[model samples]
Target: MCRTSILPSTVKAVKRGEAGSAGELRGDFDLSGDLGPLYANTGSGIFGRLEEAPRAGAAVPVGMALPGPATILANVRGDEVREYDIEILKVAPSSADGRDLVLSVTDPELLEETGGIVQGMSGSPILQNGKLVGAVTHVLLNNPEKGYGILIDHMLEAAGDGVD
Candidate 1:
């Protein structure tokens, strides 16, 4: 029963237009005692059930910790996946209703280039300790230098059901 909130409107849209898909709604059934695949993608927890499973690519494992040094892969300029250094300012545990990870863009070059997190970089992969921890889900417009990230576990759980 994975769920998430505190997402920007852009990040919460049903881009896939599939059933059981919502802006912030993802699935994660990988927890102990759970028997089904989860439908995840939003900024939440582990995998869940779904139909069209995405091709499992190189992502960090589920249940990874946060509030550490990290890197994010974002296609900010054209098709190139550029890397940016960041810091996980905070980790909003499940009790925080899926607040997930807060971030501070520490890459001076990226700031000079993009001016901060953009609208289209919502799905950018956040890597900590060389592991895929989550994705960029929101931006603090008042302070573009700061933003939020969703746990990679939630993505795994959502894609777990076999959907992209």
Candidate 2:
């Protein structure tokens, strides 16, 4: 049997307004790196075991992801991870599959460069207060500046991390 990843080999890379051959706003994506074996695709996000050790970081509780200021680490440009400012607009504690945070891009530079959330940014980590909170999930089709995020807690749960 052939196994495949939740995310396709070709990442979605394009601005929303950019038209395709059929006059449709289709996006394209480039494969930057490998994420190893992804075990879960909760619809909101994907969870996987990495091939290499990850950087040191702290994992905060989902409750910490309140409506407030946050930042997302993304690589809009080739391999260069940059932190962009954002705001947590709302928290849906009861949401299933990790769509627990609503966020909007507030960084002037990010907005000017990517024109809000484009393709190839689905799994960018959303951080707040120097801790990992959630990840960017789906972008608002009408307004690229706004998007949904999956709480880190949900992701951890889906990954079978803490269950006894």
Q: Which candidate number maximizes TM-score?
A: 2
Worst 10 residues of 2 by lDDT: 16-25
lDDT of 1 by residue, 74-153 (tens): 75543346789999999875624344888988998877665567666677888877777788877776677777877766
Q: Which stretches of candidate 1 lie over 4 Å from their true place?
A: 1-63, 95-98
Per-residue CA lDDT of model 2 for 1-164, tens digit only, reads 54443332432343432222111124343445554666666665566666665565554444468899999998765445789999999999788655688889899998777767766677888989888888988677777788788888777767685232
The C-alpha lDDT values of all candidates are 0.61, 0.70
Model 1 Cα displacement at 8 (Å)?
23
How many times do residue backbones clash in model 1? 26
Q: What value does the lDDT take at residue 152 in candidate 1?
A: 65
**How large is the C-alpha RMSD of every model relative to the true structure?**
11.2, 4.9
The lDDT, on a scale of 0 to 1, for candidate 2 is: 0.70
Q: Candidate 2, TM-score vs. the true structure?
A: 0.73
